[model samples]
Target: MHRFTRILTRVVAPVGAVALAAAFTTASFSPAAADTAPAASGPAQNYLVLYKSGGSAAGASLAAIAQARGAVVQNYAQIGVAVVSSGASGFAARLQAADPSVDSAAATASFGVSLAGDAATDAADPVSPPTPAPGSDNLSGLQWDMNQIHAPEARSISGGSSSVVVGDIDTGLDFTHPDLAPNVDFSRSVSCLGGVPDQTPSAWMDDNGHGTHTAGTIAAAKNGIGIVGVAPNVKLAGIKAGDAAGFFFPEAVVCAFMWASTHGIQVTNNSYFADPWLFNCKNDPAQRAIWESERRAIRFAQQQGTTVVAALGNFADDLAHPTQDLQSPDNTTPVARDVTNACAVVPTEIPGVIGVTADGNKQFKSFYSNYGVGAANVMAPGGDSVLQRTAAAVNGRVLSTWPASRIGSCLRKVFDSGATYCYIQGTSMASPHVAGVAALVVSSGVTSPGAVAAQIMGTADPIACPDTAMYAFFPSVDNGAPQVCQGGTAYNSFSGNGQVNALRAIGG
Candidate 1:
């Protein structure tokens, strides 16, 4: 049993505060680096240049320089540029001299930038890594328990029938992971980095572990060995929109949605959120344009019958403040104090997405989980009991998959070679459980993402308020005011539709 208490909702300090928006200018390419004469050439060269302006501009300059050098400028963007060069040696100096503003340049070969063409060929006809067979190290008995969930059983009855493809529009995925290899549709995977046009799957490999863990929850191989997934048989795809550092620029996210539309992917899971302050500045044209564009993309996905699942964010708030203060019981107004504001409740509030919140067996929303009436749609298990794996998980434990390399690094730094995995917790971990469940619903011959969402919402167990006790109390305007309880009937501004019951969800 989990304690749930209702507390007034108020705006508190921002979590993971975002810097104020900065004005940006387009990057100009240096004409000095451009080759005037046609190539009386030897071997064709490829170069990627980094500029001071931004990665997007650096890419543009590289394209212009490629044209001047008699080589073709394949693609250009703000951060970096890629070009096929006729001559190799003094290209860097020539480019620098061509434009004083140009910051620096490097050859793609020197940087070990693998082309999508090469990566695809390798993936298509490659040797498999020595991954331990699934279930080989079933060290945790959790897998066995998850198997009893209705989603997986429904998938089995359908003979693995779901053809719906869900796009993970976040960080790239580890395409080579043994648990995910069989189910991922590599053909649709794309990266928005340099405009290298081959749609081959190299971009799908997750350098950061966030996307991989999400992917695992959605469709980890059900080979009766590794961790079982909610929709183990559902088709999954990856969109490499996020960078290695886990930051996603608006351009990248927009491009990813356009790419998903073109690639025939039907469902997209966006387990990422932008800062709430962004909406506060709703008057900015650029920000408004970005938001509109996001809305358009989501609408486009819906037109194509794609379902979008988003995280409700992890910014928990108190419901009292000057900006959001409630009247005191004594009929006296007090000075406004900052209260916890539900900041993570943005885009989830956007029309099309099925926003998910994190819940544990205790049935209460995670302390970090944001709450608001139209913000979260459902809650799912995101691991509770702590297991030693990573620094973040040291306090709140959530069971899920992780990249072996990253886990090893953390283990080496902390406990030496003794640790292989860490129990972690976050709405990020919870989003996938819903995504997987959605996949299961889709696989049951449902074509509409909206329909799948409806089924999920309809099937969840309704929890009643005041059904549980308060775990703790924080000072608010009214001391005796009822705090939120874990389980409840009628939606409490916290856990929506109660915790997801896989059995009830699949209508089994």
Candidate 2:
């Protein structure tokens, strides 16, 4: 199986045991650390030179500086981020020294998939259940996740307005899928893979099925073909940030949010963590640039009326109390490193963004979903076959759209519909459900992003912690550590406001 497929299949270990490597020295960066070739060899790596806006003298225009040094391929004045390539040795350090306008200069690093990359093994020890029967919408029965969140009832109140757009900043969307074509807003979609926006719709096609799956869950049309989405009529914008190989570098992440901020997207679902580092430490000098750039973009999006929703991640660990990380810089060399409170996963841990944890069909936290007291803000059905199986929801995994070319074991080919669907699990699947509900709230006249978030949290069903004796982590294949749920019914690490109720989200 491909590494990307494995990522979608396995549950992330919270804090895998490994001896911490030596702390990264703050001395002059090496060629590899800077992600560039040696000055004597190939060209310099691309760098995101951040400029402090509204400063005295407008301090040495980045374009002029870059032209003087090398070539300026992209300029993102919206977020004060510009990408340039220069072969000069120690380019970032040298540029900072020469110009007082640059706030920070760091080489752009590639990020890997945040999910576990083990072979395609179901952690739940799944047993094949009966296929879902086609319901009123032809294939609605295949969508247990939608029914679990009461999407049908919510649809009756407000399926969603075409004017309200949900930006999916992942791999991209299969805009050609019949179920998605009716709701996809091609003009609003863009590929932000190189820290720059490419408005061509086909340029954003999803090679991996992750983005297509997420888009379907958000708004896969109510056109009576495949499964209906949580907000079946809302327009969905594909903000392609992750590439064909499933890597979401910082340049792409920063571009996606900045693109969303100005694009009139009411909400965006961020299912993958920003790449390279699993937990970007705020205090680490090396990781600070990556965190700051992404932070500004997210805050800017929120300020611009884009309600940002992100997954808490698939690692079955407490985000608030992480001790170690065994899988990091996953696109390159893997390392185990000691960490502390100063570190955090981006987008999800960022303030103002709604962080979501995953719940199974049984309404329990999915064995793989990450949770933390302050980290997770809400809960939704992501899926779990081990602890939450039902005859109706075969395999217990969330079913959504998949690209025909994208291969997976649990694929379902629709009869005469010319569309492919699949069953998969992860916090990646859970965040979109919340994104759909957020769209409903916006469609129902909640204009403010903050107000929409407040409404979702306030209207969610309150669920109390399970009895200690009854708390058991399923899937004996995993660590099987004793699971604990913190906080009361109204709010807890396991289930934020409780499970998200789509009907209540629209004031039903």
Candidate 3:
């Protein structure tokens, strides 16, 4: 299935064994080591030209791009990053040399991806679950994830306030779905596929179901239709950072963050990582530009009080103690490279952003969720089909809204009240749960991103790592390395601060 998850694909064997690959959308960019195109003018490729610190206004950089034969796709003057397009050969080298103001000119390759292209065959794995009764929001009973986090109980205290806005920075969301239509803030929604903001409704509509599913988990309306969200009354904005093919290029991601910060969005749920490289290693001169550009954007958003929450990826590897990247430049051929903690999974690993790990109904780390002592900030229900093989857990996957019109996009779908919903799994599914809780905290007057993060971590239900014997049955699918958990009970690699408690998040 074309799942929105970053997991280890068995297709490529790193060091002659199974290894890592993200299952969701991401892009490929090479700034420090640019491609040397032969001297022939061709269709333009977009480049993220980062200006030197304390550089002059965007006008100077814009002029430098022109002198180097690069057309301006966008100029983020606030953060000193610009998206420039050029057909000229060696455009990066020319741009860097053309402008003393430019710190780095990194080129995004022909990045088109079916992100996290997990070739695993789960399309027909289980029988479709029963549909919910009409007009009564009967699906609430099937929402095991909500109950796990006490969202229903929390709603009695605060279902979220209209003043708080949460943006899902993924594929655009389904604006017309009844469960989502009531809360979707179209004015704040925008598409950044072209590296600039386009607020038109059509520009940000969900084609791939990943964004739509994630939005439902965050702020689907509690208007007596389908399942309710953790922060149902909060306004939801669809920030389209990925293209129709589900590729999340640096230009689009940068634009999404800029929009979220500049607009009134108080929180953003990022379920995908920076692409091509599963772990963006700035230590590698070739990938530094991509990492720096995204890092600046994330930092800018944090500065603007936007609580950025991201997935810890689907690969069951430790982020705090990263060792190798076996599935990199995934859009192209796979390569295995030795890595260190200096390499990071974007957005999530970036300081100030809240990184989330996934847990099953049993409250153990999901079989596929990535975890690390310092990398993950919190945990939430993301479902685990393998370990949760019991009647109480149903199919062991999280359910949320899907575009009814794009029925084909969701491999397994449940039609309820003329709406389409689907059951899916991934750290991508888990990140939004924390985002929703963060919105609840924001609604309760915790406006600062730093405070919001602290409240979520502080209020979460602390969970200890499972007994070694309990998890021994499950080993890392990518490598034979034993799935190890480090750190203490209150704060550990597997569960972070622990399963996010919605009721506690709002001081209930």
What is the lDDT of every predicted structure here? Answer: 0.51, 0.74, 0.77
TM-score of 1: 0.62
The top-ranked prediction according to lDDT is 3
| Per-residue accuracy of model 2 over 73-189 as CA lDDT, tens digit each | 455665676666666667666566556677766666532112111111111111122111122466787778888888887787678777788899999988888889898888788
Candidate 1, 207-258: lDDT as tens digits: 6667777777777766644565666666678887665655444444545655
In candidate 2, list every pair of residues with a backbone clash: 111-275, 111-276
Runs with alpha carbons beyond 4 Å of true place in candidate 3: 2-39, 56-60, 110-136, 468-480
Model 3 C-alpha lDDT per residue in residues 1-508, reported as the tens digit of each score: 2224332111122233554444444344343443343345877778877877876325766676676677777767778887777887678777776677877767776422211111111111111121111222657877889989998888877788887788899889989998999988887888888587777899899888888999999987777768988888888989998766667878888988888888768899998877667788887644787888899988988887789999887767788777777656756655666778778888799989899999888899887778888888899988888776446568888889999878886666887888889888888889999999998888887888999999999999999988755556555433445678987879999999888999888888
> Which residue runs of candidate 1 sit more than 4 Å off their true CA positions?
1-140, 143-162, 193-200, 275-280, 318-346, 384-396, 409-422, 466-488
Sorted on lDDT, best first, the list reads 3, 2, 1
Q: Tell me the number of clashing residue pairs for each predicted model.
A: 54, 2, 9
lDDT for residue 162 in candidate 1, whole number 0-100: 38
Model 3 lDDT at residue 370: 80
* Model 3 TM-score, all chains together: 0.88
